[model samples]
Target chain A: MKGASEWDRHAPSSAPNPRHTRYHPRWHRERIPIFWWVGHRRYTLFILRELTAVLVLYSGLLLLAQLVAIGRGPESYQAFQGWLAEPWVLALHTFVLLGLIFHTVTWLNLAPKALVLRVGKIRVPPRAVLVGHYLAWIAVSALVAGALVWVAG
Target chain B: MSPVAKGAGGRQGTEPERVTRSREPLLWSLFSAGGMASALVLPALAGVLWVAVPAGWVAAPEHGAMLAVAAHPLTRAAVSLLLILFFFHWAHRFRYTLYDGLQLYHLNLLIAVATYGIASALSALALWIVWTLG
Candidate 1:
């Protein structure tokens, strides 16, 4: 490989092999920010958007599977339950929980800006939107959890 | 809306003041509502579903029951509805991300329309498939 100075210069006018002489952006060794790689605005936002629905869809599938097992005889349900009892499933659940938390944070952060709820002169801050979403998420999650505990009890 | 328009599409001289229109808010409003509901509902439901599995309050479905549940008309309808609304919210949100993030002038409207159109069309296809043979 040529020195940085050599790479900086334009392709030679008499280079026999044009492709080799041509300077690639990589030749400059410019460090792209980690955020630039798929973490750029489009992909990051796309993934963030999809992650929520994906969680919902996967959860739906999981719940539907359990519901089906329940619909079957007790024996079948027990077997499916055993599978869920595995350590792997617990690990997966923990991972999903972390993902959900991330989703909630990003979603709430974007929520105010997304809604763009504004007054005449002073616009509502994005942080306010996020705080509102957090309060709602916490309340709803608590209510659902409470209801589940009650039913399960 | 300022009269000192300097961007590529901004008017040169004295265009009608009426021409200064804010972007449409109808779709944005609908999406905001739907997003809020989904953001609230899904996470809540997820918690319920998660707990029920461990507590044995809800029986686990065999693969067959899972398939059958998918086959059920109500379940199929719910899934399809979720898919459509999710896509609508996603496309709407992403369009703004593209506009604001990339600063692609003059293409924002086109991109937004295209994104939503594709999402809607795909969602329709998914609904049709699930409804027919979910």
Candidate 2:
């Protein structure tokens, strides 16, 4: 919590001090290159994971826009649908779909790290946790799809 | 002034501005919740809205039906929560992305405020839209 001023006060004095002349050999820590993430596969994957948030943001905004369009009435909703029919919009959505899939898969895979299950003194395997997540995901998706079908019919 | 008093003053003066201002835990918690929510629902949303409807694999809902869905109290509340969490999730992710990706550690405060501020504003707009839907 030391302020910058405090750090400055205790900084190595520019003026040479007799007491500060001890020489020591130490390995130089590697500087994080600007492209450090690109240099490592794991780091690259982490960055991609983080970048999925942009897709989430885009999707959220799109949902809001759709809601606004719906509020404005049928013509507005039709206009919005027309806009979405453009090739560029479709392409953007394709990318968003990929990003969303990546996000979902990664999140599910990481679920075991956050959720530890044990029963009767036996710890659940990570694979079992992953299976549980996938099962729950499918169930929820089916529920949503079923609801939509029920509503539409 | 006594040396002890001067020392105390110096110690107080040198405390880093950010030391007392960390919101890491709060932001991380929101990000985690948002991630879980998005994981649960977003892919299905994308499938329905972007894939099935657009590709003509399924019929698009009539405007009246869509409106009805949006106007439902439960739908409105769920959507509002989802959108708010999504924004916070984006804020937290983008903050770290800039910090590590762009090496913007020196401008941490500015970046944090900008990211979270935008999220807050958008969340407000989203809530307003949901709340006012007929």
Candidate 3:
């Protein structure tokens, strides 16, 4: 009994029952390949969408830094601007700009799916929903630009 | 073997399993909201700041003018919200990227906590800076 208890203690928990074992044909479940996104166009695009978050983070940090620079006075603000004027900074901005555009386009395309707008008994068409998003976007941008111009002038 | 025995054996061998529910829906909602907001505003913001100003396509606002905009109460509020949402947006995307891209679902709890914590901290810092700006 002592030896049996010791053996049980060292044995695997929930051992397979021999009585339950049967000759069942195993189904081959395909494992996800490492480059799964590369296999499909949509997958690649989805990955790119996921990637644009990095650019978003970058822009957020840049804006925060600019705010801090502004608070630090005119010399610091000018220094920040000078740093942004560097060629490498310009190149990085170009890539970030492209990423932001891709992010916006993909996001707009998905808006219709996520948003179900209805007026009374009528459901708004998907195309109309997309158009509304674009129009609103343009209006907001124009408002900001106008404000900036007004402040500057 | 009899039908009863065969059925018993099959039932013992393969029972339906319950899947664990994930607590990701809450984070996903913030991600969706942030994505929508950024989609609308970020492109234009990036266009003017990174493209037009840098390329000399538009006159860059003077430092004082830019400072005035930044110091405006409405501008500060909007920017703070935008930055916070953007950070959360990045946090959610990055968490999923790690989960699916690198197959880090085993560390889901840790990753979620860490990512959201960082985002919250950064958002607080950004808000403080924006609020305290003269």
Candidate 4:
């Protein structure tokens, strides 16, 4: 404990107390680059997953626009549908569909990680949780499809 | 649950400390629920509306038929719920993405308000549209 001034004796010492440098230097953290996610496959995919929210928001807005069109009258609806039938619109939607499907897959895969289900002290298997989500997806999709095609049609 | 009471209460007589309820769990629940809701429905809806019907892979429903479906109380409820959840999901994910990906922790309050405020506004718009849709 003698010679407490040893740290201050070193050149370029701004810290007044020897104890400061004796324990450690000033805390430093490396800055993260802006494009840190670039070129990293897993990270890229993760960003893509995050990016899918854009498509999801787009889809939500798109449907609301459709409903608004419907409310405006059959002519308005027809015109809206006409715009959708355009090749470019269909192409854009094709991309949207792919992105949303990817979202669904990743969501199902990650569901069990968040939802810990147990039945009387016996934890439900993660595989079962995943299977349950998939089955729910299929059922919901089937019902919506049937409603759109059969009931609504 | 406070850390002291949340964990197995091994300390002699430590009372459960009152914890401030954070909205995080609520937002997270919305995010996941929104994700699940959109996942289960968005593809079907978008595929049918955007791709299949528009592209003629599926015959376009009778004009009145689709409108009638949209007008239904049940369908309106579902649409409102889905749209609201979708925006919230987007808000939560995009907020975190902006924070971590862009390192905008310095603007945390601004980011949270902007993200969730936009989501809430859009949800109101969706509800209005759904309400007057009949």
* Leading candidate by TM-score: 4
TM-score each candidate: 0.48, 0.82, 0.80, 0.83
Better of 1 and 3 by TM-score: 3
Off by over 4 Å in 2: A1-29, B1-22
Q: What Cα-based lDDT does every candidate model obtain?
A: 0.59, 0.82, 0.80, 0.83
Error of 3 at B43 (Å): 1.1
Best by DockQ: 2
The parts of candidate 3 lying over 4 Å away from their true place are A1-29, B1-25
lDDT of 2 by residue, A95-140 (tens): 8888998999999999999999999899999899999999988987
TM-score (second chain) of model 3: 0.80
| DockQ of each candidate relative to the true complex | 0.11, 0.43, 0.33, 0.34
Cα lDDT tens digits for candidate 1, B26-122: 6666456546655765665654555455545565434444456566887677766766665666566666665544645456556766867876786
Q: How well is each residue in A1-153 modelled by candidate 1, as lDDT tens digits?
A: 789877556544433333333645754556444345274676776656544545544553565465555555567667776777677876676566556666666667777766777789887887787788789988977875665444444
Residue range A1-153, candidate 4, lDDT tens digits: 747577466623453332232455656999889789999999989989998999989998999998898888889989999999999988999999999999999999998998899999999999999999999999998888878889544
Q: Score chain B of candidate 4 by TM-score.
A: 0.82
lDDT of 2 at B77: 95
The iRMS of the candidates, in order, is 9.4, 4.8, 6.9, 7.3
- Tell me model 2's lDDT, rounded to 2 decimals: 0.82
What lDDT tens digits, residue by residue, belong to model 3 across residues A24-134? 577797788767888698988888889899888889999999889989999998888788778898888988988998998888888899899999999999999999988
Tell me the tens digit of each residue's lDDT in model 4 across B1-134.
Answer: 42334443342122212221368889888898899999998888788879999998788887788778899998898888889999999999998899778877656666788889999999999998999886
The residue-by-residue lDDT of candidate 3 on B1-134, one tens digit each, is 43443444443333211111244676777788788888888877877777767777777789888888899999999999999999999999998887787766556666777888989999999999999998
Candidate of highest lDDT: 4
